[model samples]
Target: MNWRIETKKTALLLIDLQDKLLSVIENRERVVQKAVQIVKLAKLFSLPLYISEQVPEKLGTTCKEILEVAGDVPRLSKNTFSASPILPADIPKNILVCGIETHICVRQTVYDLRMRDKTPYVLGDAIGSRNQIDHQLGIEEMRQDRVLITSVEAIAWEMIEKAEGAFFKEFLSILK
Candidate 1:
């Protein structure tokens, strides 16, 4: 399938990156940092942003940095691993998803998004889990279902397309 990263038709879904969950994941810093970058670029390109907290009362709120970067973007508190029900009904057709526990929340959300007929793109580098095995397995599972697995930089540049435009220059500065 031809996957075009169209910012206008995409919404960035930041799922279950809560503090408690993040602390247990390996390379938490790197993953969260990349997620932050994705969120920033989504904002820069005017893409809608949606974030889900997995039972926030128990798992705690999403990290302060992610929350801050998300700004007033719609935040959903969901007990379901799949974020679809919590997400807005009018969300865009394309979803760029990034977060922790790839085998659980990330995997289920991707499946759910596909079931709903929305194109789900998993930002590979921006997702993590406590165990690398489960993380890798989840990615493979998503790929088997034809979900696009990609890096934040790939999606960002694809959205910008050209290096000389206003968005491209700003995106370059962000990458730098």
Candidate 2:
């Protein structure tokens, strides 16, 4: 429930960013752009990054844009809507999540994270769905139920603290 993203203690949990899933989201390009930014940030901060594909055999692999930036992050392939079971028990306390079809995979994962007593921070701008109303409703329910909802810039700035030196400048330029 901490508002700030403690870089060393947080992990990025990307849910169902698979091919078929991304194709139907409302803002695929925009969500992918933000996810790429987070992938770069996670690497820069040395935070663990995990991705899941809901039945990769059926939905297809994660989109190339995200896969390209994610480096060697672990990928979970399963039929489950929630990616929790596949996640390692030793993951960081703060889990930053984003992905397509917010009402299903994303929503279930957050709920499971809560049940597991892990703190989940859902990235608002980085999540999308074919039905925008469902996406919004999913977010609202999670927020009301105590899951922390946030934006990439909010989490990144707190992790960065201030825009100083070349690294900050470089990171800031990535957002442009």
Candidate 3:
């Protein structure tokens, strides 16, 4: 498997990280921090971003932190557990996925993306579930299925490459 992340051909897919879910997800604060960090890098690289909500009327909109940095990115409103269908047809093949309910929305989306022949990278640190066991299980299931499971900093730095440029300095500030 080609583990190298090609930021030029990657789209960050944030699935169902809605306000309602965030309030209950385990390690909610850390998840938001990591997700926001990844969003910042996506903006830096001009990667396409695809966000979705699992019925915002019931679950509430995505967290303010995510939306604040998401810019004018479009949001797909869906009732289905899998978000793969909503991703734009023209996005690059590399899909960086994260968000709430790892056992449900996150897992389902990864499966669907694979069926569509897209390489789905599950950001381990940015994803969450209502419970730790379920979260671990979701990660295991996805990993067993050959999804490229990775952390936010690991993949982001791989995308960033050297740390001497203005872009690198901006990304470092995010850690502060």
- Comparison by lDDT, 1 against 2, better one: 1
> Considering summed lDDT, which 10 consecutive residues are worst modelled in model 3?
167-176
Best by lDDT: 3
lDDT of 1 at 148: 90
| Candidate closer to the true structure by lDDT (higher is better), 1 or 3 | 3
**Residue 33's C-alpha lDDT in candidate 2?**
87
Tens digits of per-residue lDDT, candidate 2, 1-176, equal: 56667887799988888778788788888898899888888877788999988888777898899889897777888688888989999988889999967888888998998888888989989999898899899889888887878888888877887778988887787666
* Predicted structure 3, TM vs. truth: 0.95
TM-score per prediction, in order, is: 0.94, 0.94, 0.95
Error of 2 at 106 (Å): 0.7
Q: List runs of model 2 lying over 4 Å from the truth.
A: none
lDDT per residue, candidate 3, 1-176, as tens digits? Answer: 76678888899999988888888899999999999999988888888898999998888888899999998888899999999877777778989999988999999999988888888899999999999999999999989888878998888777877879887888788756
User: All models: lDDT?
Assistant: 0.88, 0.85, 0.89
Shift in Å, residue 82, candidate 1: 0.9
Distance (Å) between predicted and true CA of 134, model 1? 0.5
